[model samples]
Target: MHAPSQNREFLGVGWRFPLQVTPNGRIAQARHEQRIEEAIVIILSTAPGERPMLPEFGCGIHNTLFAPNDSRTIALVVHQVRQALTRYEARIDVLDVHAENNLDAPNLLLIRINYRVRETNAIGNLVYPFYIREGR
Candidate 1:
């Protein structure tokens, strides 16, 4: 995978999402990110001193069609998440999302997506850890 976008900052992050999937494209990732974004928006919109937390979000993987050796689905998910995060003026870092087992449902997968406000400073030696979870 490519280096995590430099615009986003990582301050130690992790996440958990329900392991559930249907025939349609996986919704856990999308739903998880959406909820996180909503939560951040709600918090940031509050009155001064009312904001409960800084921008942050996470999720877990459920029934997936990818394996540890398969990078296609994983890559697509990363790209999708990256694009989605951009809408929130944020980015995902240290993302680790996948199923623990390769042959079944109800897998306990965890995703640690670090969220941060986008930065304009594009000049610097920056390195972000973009971790990807897989079947193991």
Candidate 2:
């Protein structure tokens, strides 16, 4: 008897869509980085203690979202982002996290992150926008 040759499995990072199902009622799946990106987005958006089971989980930046856009606020965000990623995400090595107040929209912020994918050793960046004190 011979063993079947198989490659590494990647079920993705998040939920599945357009679930695979046929007359036989079998499940279908996909593999890619979109899942990982989605997972990171979710992790970044979730507030700490929002997860009943894991009270310490999440970036917890929502609490400071209303803070004025200033050097202090930016520093807080950088600290929080680094803390959250360091605690939650083990897939990538975070290189840098920066926040820039929008020039045209003072109540907005642009956060940039530089990271290196651990498994493939690929470098990538993530830009997340934050709306501060909206409609104020």
Candidate 3:
């Protein structure tokens, strides 16, 4: 099951991952810090796989320095997160960002971004593995 939408609103400081959003006013985020940590331990325990999806970044995992609001950062974090979901090989949606400022405190800036994931049908006959299996 996917993460709950309400968790997304919280300020994700630690090892939280923002997922999708529901039809209502809820947001989705994941708290897989422990699981990811364990995965890292296992990955490091081995001599590394031939074709590892994630590369080592000192501690043992890849892309661990990504932040929501960083200089020279624009949709890169969301893109990386979406790319990792290719296991389902679904089509990823564009990230939408909206910056809003309070009228009382006009200087205070607040950014609200939404990154949605969608699944689309694959093209070509490769979708069907069976060739000619008929018993009629």
- The candidate maximizing TM-score is 2
Q: For model 2, which pairs clash?
A: none
TM-score of 3: 0.23
Model 2 off-target regions past 4 Å?
1-13, 16-30, 134-136
Question: Residue 82 in candidate 2 has what lDDT?
Answer: 80
RMSD of each: 16.2, 5.2, 20.1
Q: Who is ahead in TM-score, 2 or 3?
A: 2
Better of 1 and 3 by lDDT: 1
lDDT of 3 by residue, 33-127 (tens): 32232332333233223346644211211332332233233244334323333322223233443333345553332433333433221121111
Report lDDT (Cα) of residue 76, candidate 2.
91
| Preferred candidate (lDDT higher): 2 or 3 | 2
TM-score of each: 0.27, 0.76, 0.23
Error of 3 at 51 (Å): 25
Model 1: CA > 4 A from native:
1-69, 89-109, 117-136
**In angstroms, how far off is 8's CA in candidate 3?**
16
| Pairs of colliding residues, candidate 3 | 5-27
> lDDT winner among the candidates?
2
- The 10-residue segment of model 1 with minimum total lDDT is 120-129
- In model 2, the Cα lDDT at residue 36 comes to 51
Expressed as tens digits, the lDDT of each residue in 1-136 for candidate 1 is 4454432334222232334464694543333334344543332223333324632322111123233524554555445444433443343232332212233322322222445423322221212222334556
> For model 2, how does the per-residue alpha-carbon lDDT over 45-84 read when each residue is reduced to its tens digit?
8899899999898996777777878898888988888888
lDDT of each: 0.35, 0.72, 0.31
